[model samples]
Target: MYIGRAVIAGYTNEKKVFLGYILASMSFPKRRARIDEESIKIEPLKTADYNNPYITYNCMKKVEKDKAVVSNGIHTDVIANKLDSGYSGRDAIAISLFAMDYEKDEYNTPRIAACFDNRSLYIGIIEKEKIIIDKVRNDRCMLISTYNKTVPEEISIKRSTAKDIAKELCMLDYEHIICSAVVCRREENDFEFATEEKNRL
Candidate 1:
């Protein structure tokens, strides 16, 4: 459980945007049991004092040591799936096309019951709470690959600990490997990302 503020610094040095590259899941990566030699050089950064501005309101307030208002750290989020049970983020946006409501042609459509649609819907519910989800970036983007070709048991156990997996990925790549949620800092131009504490669905 990665419980504190984390700053994942890999190769997201893009001037005005954040990026993520998929890393193979330790248990299911293609051929290799570990990160490829090329992807292992990426580094994870420690977010010092609310460096990432995409955390929960309570988290941001604690970091800022300020008053906690309803909107203290609220913002519109565009959540989308970065991985599937068997794929990585090589072309997440293109892949998300399937998450959209084909009938409505809306990306991250509010209603779709398939597991894939479920992931997109989960993001939508997060937005209802005022978080922003980035759903529109087409073609060849970056992601920390976690779809490693290990064993299913190892993968299940690893996925259970979001913080640890996130930390591991952060340690191996650039850009913040955002989970279900991240906090937006009021003063700094950064974000505090974490998975949702409450995953009802």
Candidate 2:
């Protein structure tokens, strides 16, 4: 019932990608969110996932506008810094992931991440020494999680809408899932962002 924490990134338009996260799960988090002029925060409800998750993290760091780094731990910052420093999306993800390797938990939980820049989306998982990274185009979605060692994949969906991915986990009859997905698009000179969430009762 524990999938740790994760993010899913995908293209919603020619110039923007939707980035969404799974709030801490399995247990209802006394979750609180704050959105101000400069930032947005979702208090983490997971104290220990695989290895004192609070120590590492399943956090996201928004790099320069148009790019973001999402990972299952502290590496999120590492990846974001890289992107901010001008590294290509793939390189940022790879370099940061390789630097952290995998969490040294009893289960050897893999670190999952997804990143996107102006027009592309990337997903990856680091497990011990094996790493899988893929560049997913704007029209489809790829799935990954931080649980036991397992391969992640890209799957097709009937509706490639914002409401779609948010329902993924909760629809499984899984009680510990808090999911959200974004649907973004770029109009003539601006970007549009739409999001949706589904939390288990």
Best by TM-score: 2
For candidate 2, write residues 6-105 as lDDT tens digits: 5566653342455555654554354432232222244544553342444334355555556665665677778878887888888888898898888886
**lDDT score at residue 174, model 2, on the 0-100 scale:** 33
Model 2 TM-score? 0.71
lDDT of 1 at 134: 31
**Predicted structure with the largest lDDT when compared to the true one:** 2
Clashes of 2: 1
Cand. 1 Cα-lDDT: 0.21
> Please, what are the lDDT tens digits per residue for candidate 1 over residues 1-201?
211122111112132122121222221112111122111111122342333322222211111221110111121111122332333222332344334322231222121110112111111111111222233232212221111211111111122132333344444332322322222222333332232312111
